[model samples]
Target: MLTMPDVRAPRLLCVEVHEGRPLSFLTETAAAHLAALAARSVFVPTTTRTRKQYRRIHLPGPPAPYAICANGGHLLVDGESDRDWQGAVARRLAEQCAPLAEVLAHLERTAHPDWTRKLRTAEELFAYVVTERALVPELWLKELSDWAGQRGWSLSAQGSKVYLVPRPLTKSAAVAEVVRRAGTEVVLTAGDSLLDADLLLAGDHGWRPGHGELADQGWTAPQVTALGERGVLAGELILAELLRRV
Candidate 1:
């Protein structure tokens, strides 16, 4: 929600690939609005990215005091993973879901190499398949989703990565921990994917852009606004609306 999806956009790029590929862009207005929000609010970045991947983007603001990474498998406090939180997550996953090894083996058996580029495990907490998005069959995805759901897991496809994550590990769970520590009551959130559903629901108010899995699925709730704006413009609008509500 914070960066442009298109790499070739003329807008100023604030997020880049480690190899300097300019993977994502952010407009100046969005940057300014984000800075303003950071000055007044907690401004935690909740993302599905791993810690290493999340660190690659440099947004305009003071570094966030806390961040939720790896879809809530890892919680970072001032850039360091909290061991206690990690241990708790590990315990929950062990008890509530099929083992990661089982999930990885299933992917290896099912994923077609013609479309699947790589199968990866992130933070040893979840598995994902990197595939050619267009070539990935919808029927195959449905089968995989169904298979995962039966095993106390879930699937989400964002961009080229198809994530297989345990149902117990969620951004909202991590956010609740943060809220408990910070003693905050009101929560505002913005996201565009099915994976973000829990976080959006946990928030007192939320927003989702007009494009993404949530948009395609026509997902919304009483407190969440489905914005018409998309791409980097949607990012700016989200920050502006967050500031207004704050």
Candidate 2:
């Protein structure tokens, strides 16, 4: 989390419970700003988290009507999977990307146990592993990216997690669907990770904090502003920025 001894951001009191314990927070100022934005505009959270994981976050606002979860593998409407959207996404992946099973098999064959800790598949749309980032070899990641690319997939390492996702499954595509449904002409977005690059690109304007994979890679587009804040402080600044624009 970003820490500044001289500057204090508002605290987000416990707003969500996970495994019977409190989790997920944003600044009090961010919470208020988001509430105001939600009241007037379409506010959709596009994330790489699975549906169950995403549900753990209780942002300060009315329940969002739409959310893109599983990095765009699933679309939730009123907290329930929209079957039509799911079907469309599945079809797109089937037509354009290699099967998740193929990628998972390759991972099982090539991954070294020394660094790989936990392997997971999200909605069978993508695969990822939690590994010791320092222990993971640079050449290995490059090789994996090259191998996946040929198979119509992409690999991204964010902190301790390395994701192998299908080329067709993306947050931007899901966000576009939400915009079409909402009939909105303007969009503002913020994120800090590589998974969010497509989303940031899809937005009219976007912000990225100075941490996460996108920051490490010096990633940006014409409409995206890269900020210097990191961690929780970055979240605060991103929300504050979004509020200012919306």
lDDT string, candidate 1, 35-116, tens digits:
8999999899999989999999898889999999999999899999999999999999999999999999999999999999
| lDDT tens per residue, model 2, 1-246 | 636664564565666688898776676767787788888889998889999888788788899999989999899999999999999998998999789999999999878999999999988789999999999999999999999999999898988999999988999999999999989999898887777888899999999888888999898889999888886678767777777776
Using Cα atoms with residue i matched to residue i, what is each candidate's TM-score against the true structure? 0.94, 0.94
Q: Judge candidate 1 at residue 237 and give its lDDT.
A: 85
Best by lDDT: 1
Write down the lDDT of every candidate, Cα atoms only.
0.91, 0.87
Q: What is the lDDT of residue 145 in candidate 2?
A: 97
